[model samples]
Target chain A: MIIECRNLKKTYVADGQAVTAVDDVNLSIAAGDFAIILGHSGSGKTTLLSMIGGLTTPDSGEVLVNGIENWHQSDARLTEMRNQTIGFIFQFASLIPTLTALENILLPLSFGNRKAASSRQARDILAQVGLKDRENAFPAQLSGGQQRRIAIARAFINQPAIILADEPTGDLDEDTEQEILAVFHEYHRQGTTFVVVTHNVHLADSQESPRILHMRKGVLSEENPARTRAA
Target chain B: MQILARQINVLDYALSSLWRRRMKNLSVLLVFTAVIFLVASFQMTTGALTRTAERVLENAPQITLQRMSAGRQVDIPPEYAARLSSIYGISRIVPRVWGYYFDEVTGANLTVMGLATDRMPMGDQLHLALASGSFPGPGSRGSVVLGRAVNDMVQARGSHLLSLFRNDLSMASFEISGVFADATDILTRDLVVMNIDDARDLFRIRGDRATDLCVYVTNPNEINTIARKIADLLPDTRVVTRPQILKTYRVVFGWRSGFGSICLLTALTAFIILAWDKASGLSQEEKREIAILKVLGWQTADILAVRFWESLLVSGISFLVGVTLAFIHVAFFDAALFRPIMVGWSVIFPPFHLVPEMTAQVVLLIFCLSVLPYLAATVIPAWHTASVPADSALSGA
Candidate 1:
């Protein structure tokens, strides 16, 4: 299994009240599987994704990515795993405002060992995102859709085995959302395992044989178990 | 090599981040530079003054003897030199006559020294560099060697002669023989050297009495012993040694500079407070930026490295600029802002250029006092922000 979770739980204290974000959630994803988690706002989809990415520690249970327990590793090793083994696309256009589109795409490589050919690879990725001519533009200079594309390109620069996106097209127009979904399909065809969390249920229709799961009030239930890839 | 390259990349991003907030950072930089300038200027000026004092006093008399009667200094009889000549270690005894002349026209105090022309040349002994013309020759009674400042004052009045009122209110005029060089102006600015008889006549001194006795010793190591002997032999006399004079100058300059530093402490405290506030109170945008970087797989150490680079760039640039400006202020413009405070009040203040003396220890001290505090201020907040879980910070929890 590329990603696995057993009875994972997370609770947050807000205004002196304990709110359970994710409770007793169990999940497994195989290599090259396309899994779409459907949930409304405050449904704990992001919290579960964060645990699988080694971004948050679960209050109980454990998360295993690539057979290594996420919370069991040292901080350095976990950070390295996040950098090399998992890619994340946040809800907003999270490109660094001071960096140009190309530089933002190359941001992940800066944290790890960057090869001499990585610059060329970044330019190639920019061209693949149909933003080759906009590489020199800063985030502020780009439209929301262009900025999202740059962020998506940044996530793919390190070529991680797992791509976890949270509402990657949350605020985009219908056409822009379809454009981003098409880019995702292209990467999925190249055999990258994807676990995308979103409120847009229409995204499930774009994937063939996608394993769809529904999360409501911190509880997760499988909607398309027959489509799930056998692990 | 890969780690170094990664650090360089982070530093590049840090620079870009600072530039994005140029206006805010510029204000902090200006205040920081000003604080450094004030402290560095005081240090450099005081250091130069102390060194100049030591250099000028190197050729001073080994021991000076003055008579004290009724708790006031009185003229010692010239025959006292004869009494001191019998001491075993005493090499030569020279009775000197010098007094302060208050010029009513300029409201300045001038030092008038009487040179013994018949003995060894005082110019060579004191290293007096003549800027023009010559010193008063032996047996020359109506000629005087003027210091640079005194010469300027005399020449400003459109005269080639300096006229002074005698003790009896009678005016005496003397030809200006020469002007002292600018290099020696710090010591000679208010000095006027003339023949011994002319000084005695001007001051109305008795022929048998001299102002003081300058005693030289054959062995420098025996100076304190000789001074003690003279003090014991002449119980009414005050004995001062060269080392004692040097110590007094060091103490005076140190105290003055310390006072100047104290006066500037308020500004430094304000700056430190500003720095602390800026560092500890991370803006929401900055917090978000750190979160985004962490979510992009940057480690806490990487974030700290970026913050370290930012602080270092600000402080390093400020230090270089402040020290350079201070060097120019002391070496070229004569520390105009701090000279009056360090040198004290004087109507005829001598304008002397200070040699810029920056030692390794002084640079290190300034770095610790100014730069390290700012770096520490930045790192603590940076560590706090970086140590938070990326998801929690991104969620603004």
Candidate 2:
């Protein structure tokens, strides 16, 4: 398994109330599996994806990536996992406003202990995302669709084993959404695991014979009848 | 080495970030520079004044004797000079009569130095040089040599003669014989040099009484011993040594300097408070920026380095600009604004050029007092913001 979660739970205190975000969720994803987690607002979709990506630790469970328990590891080791093994695509405008599009794409490699330089990789990824002409443009200068393309390109910069995307198509038109899905399909063909969390039912239906799961009120359960794989 | 190279890239990013907000940062920079300029100018002026005082005292007498009767200074008798001349280490004893003469027109006290022409050095051997006219000769009745400032004052009053008033309501008029050159203006800015007979007659000194005695020691090594003997022998008088004079100057300058520092420190404390408030209250956009970086796999240390570079760039530039402006103001323009406050009695001000004496130690002190507080102001807030996890940091925004 490329990623595994056992009895994952997370509770947040909002206004002096303990609101359970993720409850006893167990999940296992193999390499090259493109999975979609379907949920509405306030459902545990983002929280579950964040746990598997090593961004947020579960309150009472273990998140293992390539056999290394991420939650119990030191902060440095967890950061190493996030840098080398996992990538994230947030829903909002997350590009650093001060940096150019190319610089934003190159930001991940600038942080991690990556001995090798990434100038060539940065160029190639910009070309792949069809943003070669807009590399020097700041995020504020770009269209919403263009910025999302750059965010997708940044997530692919480190070539991590898994990519966790939360509502990647939240701000795109139908055509731009299709274009982004096509780009993801192209990378999915290259055996990168993708765990996408979104509320768009069309996106969930578009996946051909996919391992689709439903999350509502902090509980996650499989929905695809054809895929009955157990954790 | 790789991390260092990557940090350089982060520094580049930080530079761009600062430039993006240059207008806002410019205000902070200006205030920071003002704080530095104030502190540096105060320090430089005091240093120059202290050094100038020491140099001025170099030409002063080895030992001075003043009569103190009933806790008030009285004129010493001329006979005391002959008594002090018999001391073992005393080579020469010069009895000098000088007193403050109030100029009613100018409303400033002018120092009237009585010169015994026959015993005084002449021409280039004399410390005070005549700019144009010659010094008043011994037989030149009712004539006085004036300093440049005094000459300008008397000329401004449309009079070529100086009207000096005495405490006993007696007035004397002296013809302006000559003016001293500007080179001696520092010590003689308000001086009026005249013959002893004219000074005695103008000030109503009867029967050969002098203001004080200037003792010249034969050997430099025996100066302290001679001073001790004079103190013991002249129990009714006060003996002031050169070292004692220097010490008094040090105390005066130190007290004024400490007071100035306290004022600057208060302003500095206010600046630190402003900086701390600005830094600690990170905008929502800035918080989101940090969050995005963490999501992009940036470590806590990397975020901190970015903040550190930002603070350092602002403070470092401010320090350089402020100190440079202060140097130009003090060494070139003579610290015109601060001179009035630091130096009281503005009419008798020293007119010498200040030689800036900036050492590495001074630079380090400036750095600590100016730069370090700013860094602390920003860094503590940065550490607090960076301590939050990326997931929650975004949620707050």
Candidate 3:
């Protein structure tokens, strides 16, 4: 298994009321799986993703990434995992404005936690994303699709084993969306595990997508056979 | 050396970055520069004055005779001179008569602080060749020597080093034949030197009493013995060391030391303000940058080195520039930043003679005592900035 979550729980006290975000959930993901975590607004899908990314901690139980417990590892080791093992493609607006396309792509590698070989890999990722000549242009100068491509380049800079993206194609036109999905399909073909959270129902129901889990009101539910729209 | 090289490289980058924001840093640098320069000048001036005192004291007469009367020094009885002349190891008993004489002709108040003796005409404080003309030889009596500064003041009245026969009431003309320079008094910069008898005749104490006896000891080591013996022999008189005699000029030296203190205090206050401004004016973005650097494996000491170099570069540049500018101000313009009392009194200090010692030790002290405390003071805020988490730092900026 690539990721193992055993009885993971996250709770928040908001307005003096105890709210369970991820309640005693257990899940496992294998390598080479392109999974979609489907959820409505306020369903804690992003929160679950954050815990899985080691950006935050679960209240109890274990998040073991290749048998290394995220809860027990030092913050430095956790950051290393984030830097080396997991790549996050944030929403459309997450690109840094002051950074050029190449600099933005190299941001994760610039953290002093990666090898020089990873910098070469970052350049390769930029070229693969079709931003070879646009490296010097800043985000404001780039089109939204191009900016997302540079962000994708940044995400894969360390050649992480898993890529987690939140709404990677939410703001793109149909053509640009298909181009981005093609890049995802290409990475999935290369056996990199992928998890995407999106409101695209068609994407959630794709036949090739693996193990799509739907969430509502901070709780995950198994889709019924009667509800066959989901893949 | 490599670490220092890298530090200098970083300093160069930081300096260039600061240069991009010149207007802000320039004002701070100017204020800092002015304060440091003024402080340095004040230190140099005080140092010069103390050295001046030391030089004069070091070269002054080792022995002096003073008469005590009602808590003020009075004239030693002239009869005591002959008696003092007979004291053992006393090579000379130079009876001196000096009093303020406002010359009616020159309209100048001449301070006759020291007098020419009977055999040795110019007293311990003088050399006759330094006079404009000539001093009388060993046998000359009733001939007086006049300092060029004094002769110029009095319009060259006397015809000899000592004049026993004629008396001129207006300029104290008493046969002053020679002219001298170098040794001087405040009131007698334009001086009239004369034989002790001529001064005695002018003061109308022909055989009664003279002021102080300028004694030259045969054995300097016997000064205490001689001074004690003289004090006992002339029970009515008191004795003082040469520096003590020089201390009478303390009104001048006191004013000097006091002025130096005030200027330095002003400079120090300005230094405090400069340090305060440097500390308080660092922006949140700059602090965040430091925080990020710290998170990226920069050691605490490396960050401190950055601050140290930053301050040193600012102060060091300002120091060089300020000192250069002040040297021009003093050297070319004949100006003391804070005018010396002699400076303001129309005595032209010799050109190119501002012998200020800017020693490495002093430079180190200026950095260690003044600028280092300031750099260390910055540690609290810089450390506070460095201690901030990278996430908050990145997010805030």
Candidate 4:
């Protein structure tokens, strides 16, 4: 298993009241699985994904990513895990606005151990995303699709075993969404596991798209997920 | 790499984000600029006042002497002035030629403290540069070296001729010659210098009788002991040292030190409030930006370092602008406004022309006490808000 979570729970305090954001959630994603968690606004899809990404810790429960006990690790170690073993694609592209496309992709690489953060790995990764021509473009200069594409490139830039995408297609139109999904499919074929969160019912309905899955309002359901081929 | 990496690099990020909202940044910077200007002006004025006080305490008046009687007025015959030179510490004594002459042209009335020395160390301190007229040469008669301001005034009076009164009745005329500046005493510019014989003749003081004795001690500190001993030896007369003669000034500078404190305190309080406002008013979006930076693998130290850089940059700009503008403000503007604020006319010429001291230490201290506080003020807040719960922090934006 590239990603695993067991009995995850989160309670948020607001105005002196405790509200459960994620309650007793358990999930697992293996290599070669491309799954999407479907939910509406406030359905806790983002919260669940945030916990698996180690950006937040659950009030009670354990999460392991590639045999590493993530919840038990120090913040430094957890950050290292996120940087090297797991990739996070937030709902918004959230590409560092100040950095160029190439620099943003290479940002995660710089955070972990120094091997791929070096010049050689950065060059090869940017080339892999077919973004060599657009390396120097800032996010504002790029189209929404292009920015999302750069974000997709960043997710795989460090060669993380699992990519946790929280609505990677949220800001895109249908045609651009297809292009972004195509990029995710190409990386998934290379044996990368994906746990994507989205509210798009069409994406959830496509049995050909998601493999192992769960819905925040519903429950986990294993289906014949679409298998994509690398070009 | 450490030197180049930046003290607070995230400050650059903060500023860039602030820049996207440039109008807000400009308002903040404008208020900041006004505060810096006020601080620099105050500090420099205080420094100038301190220096002027130092200058006034340094030199003795040219023709210093004691009164023959303990009473305020001395009525001695002129003939005894030349013979008084036989006394120890008496380089020479000349008669008091005149009681006091009021020069209407210069607006001063001072008793002529007659001199017999050819050249004097007391005169050198007053010089804008050295002067080369006769040094009261061997019974030199009817010659005078004018103090810088008096010389200019006398020269300005036109027709080098000057009128002096004797016995408060007879008139004496003299020529204006050389002028001196860089004075050790402010009173030096107001006194008139004349030769021993001419003074004796003018005052009609004769023989071993002079109003008072003027002493030049080889060792300056021995003046007090020498004055006491001479007072014991010459029970009829008294000895006075130049330093002791000029004792009314110590209280003025005593007032200056207190004024400097007020200036520094005002500046310090203003600085702290400005910092508190800037640090406290940071919005949620700003916090989210910092949190994102933290989550993006920036260490807590790294995030803090960035704010430090931003603060430093702001301070550096303030110092440069503040000091430069202050220099111009003092140089062109009258320091009267500051004098009332720093020490308030306590008999010191409040400095209007200030040459800025831009040494590394001054710059560093300025930054440390003033700018560094503003810059470093943001650290704990930035760090605490940065290492926040991700969801709440993000939602703040």
Candidate 5:
């Protein structure tokens, strides 16, 4: 398994009231399997993905990446895992504004011990995103679609076994949204495991062989493709 | 090595980030520089004052015998010089006649010192360039040598001769034979040098009495012993030693400089508050930047290291520029803004040049007070911000 979560639970308290974000979540994502967690806003999709990505620890139970318990590791080791074992694509294409597109793509390499190989990979990713001409341009100078393309390039620059994306297409227009989905489809064909969280049904429905999951009120359940397609 | 390179890259990014907000950071830099400049200028002035006092007192007489009656300085009989010469370890005793002459026209108190022509220190030690004629001859009574300041004041008043009213309600006059050079302005400004006999005659000291006796010892190491012996010999006399004078100078300068430091620290307190506010209150955009770094798998310590470099860059640049400007201001401009308060309220402001006494201790102190506090102030807020999960920061929570 590329990703595993056992009895995972996360809770937050706001204004003296305990709110469950994710509860008793058990999940497994096999290597090279592209999976999507479909949910409405505040349906614990992002929280579940965050825990699986090792960005946050669950209040109970454990998460193992590549059969190695991640939550029990030191923070440095966790960071190293995030650098080498997983990639993240945030909702807003969070490229550092001061850095060029190429530099933004190369940022994750800074957390790891690789510099030269990562620099070459960052350049190759920029070219792959068709933003080779805009490598030196800052994010503010790029269009929304172009910025998102660079963000996608940054996400997979490390060639991680699994990529976790949270609402990746939520901020895009219809045309740009389709373009980003095409990129995801292209990456999925390359046998990279994807655990994507999104509210858009088209993302899960469009996949020919999708392992879809539905989340509602912090509860996760396997979705029947026939029902999703009929809906 | 890879970690170091990565950190260097991050520092480069930090520089770019700071440059984007240069306008805001410039204000902090200017204010920080100003605080450092004020503190440095004050320190440099006090250091210079202390050094000048030491140099002037280096070759001065080891012991000065003054007649004191009920805690007031009185004129000693000239016979004390002869009596002091016979004391052990006394090489030479010179009876010096010096008194303060208040120049009413300029409102400056000019020191009138009488010296034996044969006994003045030669060459540069004389501190006089002989702007005009010559020192008054030994036998030349009622003849005086005026300092440049005193000469200018008397000449401005259309009088070439020094006019004085004697203690006996009689008038005396002295011819200005020459004026001492400008090089000695630090010590001799507002001074009138004359023959000992002329000084005695002008001041109306009856029957060969001099103002004080300056005793030079054969061995400098025996000054304290000789001072005690002199005190025993002249029970009603007061003896002043060079070390005592140096200590008094140190205390005076230290107290004055310490007070200036307190005042400067008041300004620094305001700066510290401003810095703390800026550091503690990270903007939404700034928080997001940290979040972005965290999402890229930067550890909390890495985030803090970036913040440390940012503060170090700001405070370090400010310190260098501030200290350099202060040196120029104090050494070259004669510490114009602070001289009046620091040098005292005298009309004759001495020409002072401060040596750059930036010892390792002082540099460390500047760092501790300015840079360290700045780093400390930012670290806490940065840690708090970094402690938040990257998922939340990226979500803009």
Candidate 6:
């Protein structure tokens, strides 16, 4: 299993009330599997994806990436794991406004050891995302779809083993959504493991042979037993 | 090599980040620069004045003896030199005549000193350099050597001879024999030197009396002992050593500079408070930016590094600009803004160039005082922002 969560649970306190964001979730995904977590708003799908990406700590569970428990690693080691093994695409276009599109794409490479030949790879990815001409434009100058495409290009610049995306197509129009899904299909065909969390149920139908899981309140359940591949 | 590249990349990002908010950072830079300028100016002026005093006093007498009467300084009898001859390790003893002359014409006080005829070529003894003409000789009784400042005052009045009222209220005229060099202007600005006999006659002192007696010691280590002996022998006399005079000058200059720094403390405190407020209170946009960086796989250390670079660039540039301006202020403009306070008020102030003194220790002191505090003030806030979990911050939880 490339990723596994054992009895994951998370509770947040809001105005002196305990809200369990993710409760007792168990899951696993193989190296090249595409898993889509479907849920409505406030259903803990984002929290579960966050735990799997080592971004948020669970109150009572273990997240293992390549069999190494995420919480057991030092902060530096975990950060390195995040940098070299996984890529994250958030719901909003989380681009640094101060940086140009090319610089934004090159940011993840700054934290890793791959410096000598990464600029060419970044340019190649920018061209792949059809944003080769917008490389010098800052996030503020780029349209929302352009910025999202640049962010997706940034994620693929590192060519990580797993891509954790939360509502990757949440706020886009249908045409741009199909374009982004097409880009995802291209990467999926190249064998990149994906864990996408979204409130849109239609996203499950857009992927190829994807294992769809439904989340309600704070629990996760598989929707289609035939599509669930054993890790 | 990769680590260096990564740091360079992050520094580039830091620079761009600062430029992105250039207006906000520029205001902070201006205030920071101003505070540094105040501190560096005070330090440089004080250092230069102290150095000038030390250099001038290097040729001063090892011990000076003056008689006291009713808590006021009275002329010591020339016979006091004979008593000092009995002391061991005494190299030379000279009874000196010098006094202050109030000039009604310019409303300034002038220092008048009588030089012994035998000490003619006092170039070595007093570090005196003549800009023109010669020192007063044995027969030049009614002749005087004027310092640059005094000569300028006299020349401005369209005269070569300086006239002053003697002790009996009679006008005495003396020819201006020479002008002291500009290099010695700080020490000789209001000085007038004449033959000892002429000085005594003008001041109306008895032939047997002198204003003070200067005692030079052959071995410097025995100066204090000799001073103590002189004090004991002449119970009503004050014996001041060269070290004591130097120490007094240092204390005065140090106190004045410290006072200047203290006066500037309010501005410095306000700036620090402003910096602390700006750092501690991160805007929602900034907090979200930190979260985005964290999600992009930057560690807390890397985030801190970016913040560190931002601060270092601001402070380093301010420090350089401030110190450079201070050097120019002290060395070229004569610290005009601080001169009245640092050098004290005078009607006939000497115009001397200060050799700007900048040492590593001084640079380090300014850095520690100005830059370190700013950097420290930002650290906790930066760490607080960096340590937040990306998911929690992004979800606004």
- Best candidate according to DockQ: 6
Error of 2 at B355 (Å): 3.0
TM-score of chain A of each: 0.95, 0.92, 0.87, 0.83, 0.91, 0.95
- Estimate, for each residue in A50-157, the C-alpha lDDT of model 5 and write its tens digit: 888787778998999999888788988888888887889887788878788988887787756555556777877777767778999999999887888888888988
Per-residue lDDT over B331-372 for candidate 2, one digit per residue giving the tens place of the 0 to 100 score: 888877687666664434555445565767667888899999
lDDT of 1 by residue, A1-231 (tens): 999999999999999999999989999999988999999999999899888988888999899999999888998899889889888888777767777898888878876767754788999888877788998998999998888888888889899899999888877778878877888898898889999999888888887668889899888999859755432
User: What tens-digit string does per-residue lDDT give for candidate 1 at B220-299?
Assistant: 99999999999999999999999998888788889998998887767776777777788778877677777777877888
Name the regions of candidate 1 deviating beyond 4 angstroms.
A14-18, A113-124, A130-133, A136-143, A228-231, B68-75, B86-89, B100-109, B116-125, B128-146, B151-183, B194-209, B218-229, B346-350, B393-397
Give the DockQ (2 decimals) of all models.
Answer: 0.50, 0.40, 0.10, 0.25, 0.48, 0.53
TM values, all candidates: 0.87, 0.79, 0.61, 0.72, 0.82, 0.88
Candidate with the larger TM-score of 1 and 6: 6
Best by TM-score: 6
lDDT tens digits, residue span A125-231, model 3: 77787777887897889988888888777777666899888777777788777767777888887888987877677675433556677767667655553343234
lDDT of 6 by residue, B26-65 (tens): 9889889988998999998888877766776676678888
What TM-score results for chain B when candidate 3 is compared with the true chain B? 0.68
Docking class of predicted structure 1: medium
Per-structure clash totals for the candidates: 0, 0, 19, 21, 0, 0
lDDT of 6 by residue, A116-215 (tens): 5477888888888778888899999988988888888888888888999888887777987887888788898899999999888888778788888889
Fraction of true contacts kept, per model? 0.47, 0.48, 0.00, 0.16, 0.55, 0.53
lDDT of 3 at A28: 75
Ranking by lDDT: 6, 1, 2, 5, 3, 4
Q: How many pairs of residues collide in model 2? A: 0
Q: Predicted candidate 2: what Cα RMSD to the true structure?
A: 5.8
Rate residue A180 of model 4 by lDDT. Answer: 65
| Residue B13 Cα positional deviation in candidate 2, in Å, after optimal superposition | 2.1
